[model samples]
Target: MTYDRCLATLKAISGREAASGYSQRALKQVFGTSKVTFPLSYDRQEFFSKSVEYSKGISISGVQEKLSLRLDRASNELVVTRNNGEYILKPSPEAFPNAAENEHAAMLASQKIGIETALCTLVPFKTGELAYLTRRFDRLESGDKRPQEDLLQIGGLPPKAKYDVSYEKAGELVDQATGGKRAVKLDLFRRVLFAYAIGNNDLHTKNLSLQRAVESSSRFYDKLTPNYDVLFVQAFDNTKEGQFMACDLLTDPETGEEEFTEPYQEYGFYTGYDFLELGRRYGLPERAVIRAIRNQVDSQGDMIELIQSSYMPEEMKREAEVIVVGRCRAISTGIDR
Candidate 1:
């Protein structure tokens, strides 16, 4: 059976067919409205005409070109907006082939592994080229904006220096921001492991952020936001570097040097031991750490199924599967090959 483009689920849920090329669950997740006829009036060509103007309103920076857009429920379409945009539209850049599909599949995989992620799905332009559409979590249904800050800002680093810090430091920042909350720290550990398992080498400082809780009665006001900007960057041809992670897993506090495990030195890449050591250093519970690693290790079958069912081209799908399986192997065992 063919899968639906929005959620990659079987075409029929229960007994009803998805007339809109989207499953009911996907429509609810992405649009939050029950209407099944949501459409975008403009295509990629028209998007290029206004990308510069629309991007000016976007605050996030990355390799992909994105436009700020808002949904017009009355018109049943998405319209480009200069301000108060509720959704971010990312089209495949000329250099990255099938990036929309890559990102969508990655986000879906993240969810399957129990990582909380922003609402996202693939929406086609008027001409039929698919683009990644993610709903902004900071925006409330009541039109109020929540305070959200990325780790770069929290670390007091400039945007250009986002890659200069280590993942260990990032974890410390999260710990401090949430008053040493163990739940958030466990989430951080899971995020770090998931990134490695998928070969996503772009989980830099700017990509991780915390959002201020809307309710004052909550236990912690500053909470880690859902995962965003996740994709299999290593699957691309241009990113053939030997680096398994974007940032160093750890650095000596006094010596200020990159620290590695003996297995890392021998295998030339991080292994299960390195991640376990990281969890230990972070003070994560022994059971939680083991469970997190085991979850990722066991996700191989589900991840491969999701990749095969994704909208990525046949070639890209195979590349992504190989990368995921290889990384999962490294995380499951000390062997790199």
Candidate 2:
């Protein structure tokens, strides 16, 4: 909430110590300019007033309030725009505490574990509150919008049904849509494992998506889009009642029963074997499955390190670390353990 020497570093925008502000590398990546900070042309009061009118007819999905904006390199400022915006800004949701910092930290952690994530960072509003900002991966350098579709629409489901589908079914739909691309399936498997490891229980159908391949001639989108909308939901209060995963990972499709390994039944959490079973069900090779699970397990320290150095409040950072460690432990051990 307060500015420090390591603000940009803590936000995961800069890897090195940025004593003055954002490092050159980070500034180049996010702003495509030499700006020290992403100063907005509008203040918080103006943003709050204008965003309401700007949000109408905005096609972007999700429950968070979003404003589309474009970077003016000539002026070195980000300005609100109703059309052809290159970035999506998410101010902290009133209902969700520290949502902006939570998302920025989680997204960087996801990238650390090898998940392809949308380029994002935490930008300070003129009022000093931090907001989550992500570049629109669906847009090109020429300001052209790429063909992109979330899994919900691809599966012919409405927004209300986003939470109704299972990962197994979603993966199946993705396989069909992508023409059974093995690499895409493998990436999907890794993403699912990463989501669970981070205690991101909000990775429903609408969160996963595909974009049209830049080189392809086909009309269908055959490429998986970068991961987005990821954050640690367990850091919030009163969020522990639901299942571990957003979808029915433990459900037996044929029997319509939730299946749990012996350790799961005893300990009441998924073990490494459960993840292995899921990879197998998703038709990923055994070696790849083992590797993906190992990737998540091995990145435990990195995830915690990011959380500790994040812009989240101290209490929330500690809570997030505990949640991530618990999930990582759950996913690292076998059923026998």
Top candidate by TM-score: 1
Query: Residue 7 of candidate 2: its Cα lDDT?
Result: 41
lDDT of 1: 0.79
TM-score of 1: 0.91
Candidate 2 RMSD to the correct structure? 3.1
Off by over 4 Å in 1: 1-19, 36-39, 57-62, 217-221, 334-337
In model 1, the Cα lDDT at residue 78 comes to: 80
Q: After superposition, how far is residue 234 of candidate 1 from its true place, in Å?
A: 0.9
Worst 10 residues of 1 by lDDT: 8-17
After aligning candidate 2 to the native by TM-score, how far in Å is the CA of 325 from where it should be? 1.2
Candidate 2: minimum summed lDDT over ten consecutive residues — where? 12-21
